[model samples]
Target: MEQTSLNLVAIAVFVMTLSALLSPALNISPFIPAGTTLGILTLATLDSVSWGGRGLTIFLDLFATPQQRQRVIHHEAGHFLAAYCLGIPITSYTLSAWEAFKQGQPGLGGVQFDLTLLSDTKTIQKTPLIIERTLTVLMAGIAAEMMIYDNVEGGEEDKKNLRAIMRIMGISNSLYQQKESWALLQAKNLIIRNQTAYDALIEMMEKRASVEACQSLIQEKINQIEVMT
Candidate 1:
């Protein structure tokens, strides 16, 4: 869901109640409010447990403006492109809750990296560069959002992912903020450096292009950047 589940439900309840109150003067069916509420809950439940709440996202996103949609594409593209540039294998990605659900992802939208490397704790501990790469990847989405929006709305789970990695490293919380700033700057610079590839990625990502296709396109675009420079 773009908004929190609780907030969405609250908004639904408020609107239904308002509809009920206005039904008398508006000559709308008195049962309309109750029916709508029940229908929404039924759909929400079915979609949640069975469909990763995909239908709900579709419903809610019907109200989402074009800018909001673009923001999501841009945000995920940041992660996808950064991972590609860092020599990380990207497995898949999604641009919406429904697409994510279809792909069996737990969350609404994201770029997925190779789990084989991610699950290897031994390799990570042996290579501090791995940590640097992971930090930059995690910060890339937020950095991308900040690039276009000048602030961030997404990346809550991203921040949590970073904190978990820090805990695994036994790093002190005191340095968390500084580390985050550095990571963001690193990711932002990466995005800026690959501006053309990043732009191409946003279009492909929005269309939910295959990882292989985007991978090919990214290399081609980066080569073009190299040629021009």
Candidate 2:
């Protein structure tokens, strides 16, 4: 929900910037309104990218300080690790905030995973398991941050995370609550088990590694986890 709003804002900004930049060349008299509208559209597009889970979050984090970026990396790693443990296949991952920013999206970081719940065509009810796994994955990021920082930064981003959880809970009711707790436990365990990978991810983030580099590192780490399991 919040991501959608941010995308709208980003689209608006982009449209405005585009119009402003082109107004002089176009010799337009109504540049102000045109630029403003264009900017709004740009912001909207960015928000869409974020909601679509297109690495916009990673792009936005590029402006963050090293400490903040490290925190984000750890946070995202928690999510990835938990998902992996739950048998969720990751599609790709990125640590670059610039990539996200250029894409005009929200969130400082994110990991994309396959949303498919089963491999077979049988219609067995796996909704419960899927919901449980997803909630656990969502909370894993905060759990990771909490484990390391002892608490979160209490920023807009953190609030967004909390809201997302709450929204899920509202829809899923008690089931979501139960799954969230389970997810947190799973995340904590994964963090402990994959401390090395977590450390390496943070180090890579500190160096502002490109998306490709981050993806490669994460894949390698995933392979290591598979070997250990």
Which residue pairs of candidate 1 clash?
none
Q: Residue 207 CA error for candidate 1 (Å)?
A: 3.5
lDDT of 2: 0.62
Worst 10 residues of 2 by lDDT: 117-126
lDDT, candidate 1, 23-139, per-residue tens: 999999978888888777666666677756556665676687788888989899999888989877788888776677678776566898874655666766777787888889999
Compared with the true structure, model 2 gives a TM-score of 0.53
Give residue 18's error in model 1 in angstroms: 1.1
How do all models score by TM-score?
Answer: 0.86, 0.53
Candidate RMSDs in Å, in order, are 2.6, 8.3
lDDT of each: 0.83, 0.62
Clashes of each: 0, 31
lDDT of 2 by residue, 1-229 (tens): 3564465466666767776787789986666757668665565466565455344444444456877766767777777666666767666565565545554543443676676653222321435566556666767787888899999652345334534644643545545456556667876777787777767766775575654575567668878888888
